[model samples]
Target: MWWYTFAHVVYHLIRWFPKNNRLKIRIVIVLFSFGLLFPQLFVLSREHSTRYCGQHLFDFLIVSIVFTFFMIGFSFIFSLMDPVPWEVKLAFHIFGVIAFVMGLTLTVFASLAVDCRNNTLELYYLSVSAAVLTVTSFAFLMVMIPFWLLNYFFPNSVLNRKERTGVCYEPTACCSCLWHI
Candidate 1:
């Protein structure tokens, strides 16, 4: 669908967020999260509630979708920030991978729990999967919080010029808007 195409374009452009633009990165993350999350909320809300639990579970799915979407979008930025400390980059990547694995686990569990054709929910197992997904998403966000704050305040990043291998590129409006072009 158009979602896949939009994500593909974002995946390509996110890599261009300069290593020094930690502030920009943080801002973009917030904005992107907001843009995607709200539309998802509206759509999910329009979906009929088969049961209270089912409605809630669907909301849970929306949360998982939003966080996973942001993580995937930011994966490119984290990978390209060569000027960042190894510790920071390693931490983000490790947590990101864990989030992905847990998300996959949740998806498989959810699918197995739902009898789509019958329009029935295996309430127990689906709830369990949602719980697991929630915990993983919470952990991932916690890990990212420190990094985002550091970047927001420092603007430069976790390392100085002498420690990193290459110069960090400063984001300019035009350069950062390569996605638009």
Candidate 2:
């Protein structure tokens, strides 16, 4: 459920990113500031939190901030590909979710491994699962790569009936719904 919401928010943010100069500048400034202070903040948080629960809370806070920064960077980078279709952007967002999940699983496994040394086999299994997810995420990208290549290599194969008027008269089923909205 949260994934759906986050994806929706990211999609809209990407949609707006190319149009908003002020947002672009602000995002760049925020990213720069966070990059400078993140290491210090993370080290300080780790030193101050003695309790396991408090340490976990700090970890969560830091992870969330880093994830936000990552999303902004992701959107900014994708927005730079101005000629790309919206469907491709959506695909990239889905790819990002898969990658994020893989990363999260690995982080959990790493964090728990030290405390649960007796469960060495279980941690190995978790590591294997994360590896599987990593493969699956890239597999998704591999599937999309051919289509992107086709689009790039044969741009004229895709029809744009009303290029000047910014209208697609013969929209495909996938794009028709988006066009109406």
Candidate 3:
């Protein structure tokens, strides 16, 4: 739906950004998408809980989703500097990927377990739908993060940084930096 549209936009936009900022932007988008999708999972859990385990699981999901969304928002707002080191970028990317995978796995497993008790098809559908969305979002994030990181860390290899800074068009052929432009 609209999420796919947003993802597509993000995908293309990442191509134009400097490499280092690309990963950061993807991570932000992934976090924002997670925040956007959490409510659907919460509502599904609420409707299908018959046992105490279901309630516990629902509570756990709510807490996890809230905490994740908070962290993503905080990180996005705080990290504005350019050329983040490779190690820091890798760490964030790894953390986000692991968290996303684990969360989706847990949701799927819990949904299947609940389905056993309730014999309801809706639970299965909800679980599968959530998994699909989670996977799609994560896949987009994976592509964008690495692409941006490569660009940022190795700008000269792929893009002409001098041209981007407007130094190539100078008429005087001066050795001065592009800051004058």
Candidate 4:
């Protein structure tokens, strides 16, 4: 169901682009690059000297999500501009970085600082959750991109043989079965 929602949103988001495939591809590449950055940060955080720092994988995931949100927001803002002014783009870029840092700090404080630290299992749980969710999101994007491009280039090309004659499944159906849960 959440996958359905994600696909629905992404479908609309792809369509929301200005019909220039080059620009669309560029935006998708940028977003995917940002997506790839999280795991490197996760690796770095794991090597931190402080135990508490690496102990909270869920907190790190939260920070990553917050940063991704800010990135997407900034991308949307940039997409709205026709001929983007250098100063305006620079200003938004600085604001996005500041906002992401603020969000990361708040999430860390909320998830780690306020919680009681006696149990070791919670640490394990956070780490496991972060790993699982990170992998899931990464795989989801991997699956989504091909389907998105298929839908973009050759829309509604797949047929649903079990259904009525000539009925077709949308390209999103490619990964919908795997992620429907």
Which is the leading candidate under lDDT? 3
Model 4 lDDT tens row, 63-159: 5555555555545545445465888657654754464454445444435533324433444444444444434544555666665566566644434
Q: TM-score of the candidate numbered 3?
A: 0.44
Let me know the TM-score candidate 1 reaches against the reference structure: 0.37
Residue 113's lDDT in candidate 1: 51
Structure candidate 3, residue pairs in collision? 19-148, 19-151, 19-152, 20-152
**Which lDDT values do the candidates have, in the order given?**
0.49, 0.46, 0.50, 0.46
| Pairs in clash, predicted candidate 4 | none
**What TM-score would every model get versus the actual structure?**
0.37, 0.33, 0.44, 0.31
After TM-score superposition, the amount by which residue 123's alpha carbon in candidate 2 deviates from its true location, in angstroms, is 6.4
Q: For every model in order, what is the number of clashing pairs?
A: 0, 0, 4, 0
What lDDT is obtained when candidate 1 is compared to the true structure? 0.49
**Candidates in descending TM-score order:** 3, 1, 2, 4
Which lDDT tens digits does candidate 3 get at residues 47-141? 55333444244443554465455444435433443344677556555655556755566566655555344543444444455556566776765
Off by over 4 Å in 4: 1-121, 158-181
Candidate 3 off by > 4 Å: 1-60, 75-97, 107-126, 159-181
